[model samples]
Target: MQYLESFYNYLQYERRNSSHTIVAYKNDLRQFCEFLEQENIELWVNVTSKVIRSWMVQLVNEGVSPRTVTRKISTLKVLFKFLMLEDVVDSNVAKHVITPKIPKKLPAFVKETEMDFLLDSIEFGQDFTGLRDKLIIEIFYHTGMRLSELVGLMDCQIDAGNDVFKIYGKRSKERIVPIIKELKVSLVRYLNERDKLFPEKRNPYLLITEKGLPVYHKLVYRVVNSYLGQVSTVVKKSPHVIRHTFATALLNRGADLNAIKELLGHSNLAATEIYTHNTFEKLNSIYKQAHPRAEKMEDYI
Candidate 1:
């Protein structure tokens, strides 16, 4: 436990990991520590690669997601590395284990035509929940914020007058996302609706439930899914899909890669480059249709 606490402080103070990542690391380590106790392994240094393999097997047998299992394995690897650095472990056995393969799937995004129809054609009611749901979708599409960052948003973080809001991304890295005029109007309306619902009550979170509690993950997912299900055929209709739509739209419109990266609060350009695939696909389609020699390329080849 002392070692675990030390590792946690290292992550917090030294590594400056976000609260979300810290929680995930703690949860994964807790499960591994429980397994250690069951196996009667007293010290992390005494744990072997064989025991780690056995745990991975158990996780697979219990039907844990391959992605999730891979993440847990990574957590163990990091922990063992930290232990070795602290001189508590002579060797890092977890590094010997291989990670599971994850499928390569492009991020799903709503088409521009589909979003245009959804926003312009659909008439969200003029009331509280209606305005809230509409604003939820609008914020996601407009700002490209992750679900957690948006959920954790506060009224003070929004600066409608300046047309920008402060976003706290992964690792709690702060960025300012400039909002458009339409979104600014939607936000003002949503706030008025919220105040009407909870006139005497006070909540710090910008978005809230009908009962005035801060909106959570499941509710946000349901809101995005239900709306997207009506308007889009994309298999993924979560807030992330909306985020992808925002990024892809920017890329397709000739937004600079670095600017998009900054706006999305990505830690690196690599993460932002995924959106380029969609733009490349669009260019390919255009070239096939309009390029004079595109259709007859095989003749010269």
Candidate 2:
């Protein structure tokens, strides 16, 4: 509680973390602080490794997922590290705490054929809303950008001459994502239609509502979910699904992991490596179908 505000300011201004991240950190710290209060602890220095582990055990007993528990532990590490830098604590108590191991869940992606059907067979109509919706979906799958990046995309950020998008990803990190010719064509058409539909609107964002205001997160989510549901039975049909589809599609086509990491604006290659699991599944399926000995071996097993 003492240096919490200072830590938040450090995350916001010094680390340049997104507001979403800041809020998550805040919530995690609040929950930890509440746990401390229950233990009758009043100061940062009073927190111990044992108490932190006990709080973690309580969270698990309360049915929190291991993945979420890991994130909360990460929040504690950052908090105590900040506390040490500010001389609030002599040593970091959370540094040695063992966190729950998260299960490796493969990222879900839309099948290439299903994506093809949605774009090629689906008739989104010629109205402003329909055009906007189609373009939104195209951008998501083409760019592999996160929802916030797409929502905050500015017209000036699109480099038509270079056939690339200047995307501001998590923590305001910038990356250039190149576009294919087909996507370039779709983008040009959408920009023209957007201008014609809202001629006088001065919004700088690339995507906007029929009311000429910048499009919000829910609007984008609905557009992706509605279209993806028709083609993909994937339980989660959000914008991030399309982002997954984009990454998997690239990996399937032999795109380099490092290249994909750059395009997706991931800070490290480990985040991009998850797509390889999906690619491996695809190859395994193809092997089962194409290799004569594969099916025979499977039957023997």
* Cα lDDT listed for each candidate: 0.91, 0.91
Mind sharing the TM-score for model 2? 0.69
- Residue 297 error, candidate 1, Å: 1.7
Top candidate when judged by TM-score against the true structure: 2
CA RMSD of all predictions: 8.5, 6.8
Query: How well is each residue in 60-173 modelled by candidate 2, as lDDT tens digits?
Result: 999999999989999999999999999999998999999998888999889999999999999997877888898899988888989999999999998888888999988888
TM-scores of all models? 0.67, 0.69
How high a TM-score does candidate 1 get? 0.67
Q: Please provide, for model 1 over 154-244, each residue's C-alpha lDDT reduced to its tens digit, 9 standing for 90 to 100.
A: 9889886788999999999999999899998899899887887789758799999989999999999998999898989999889999999
As for candidate 1, its clashing pairs are none
The whole-model C-alpha lDDT of candidate 1 against the native structure comes to: 0.91
Worst-scoring 10-residue span by lDDT in model 1: 98-107
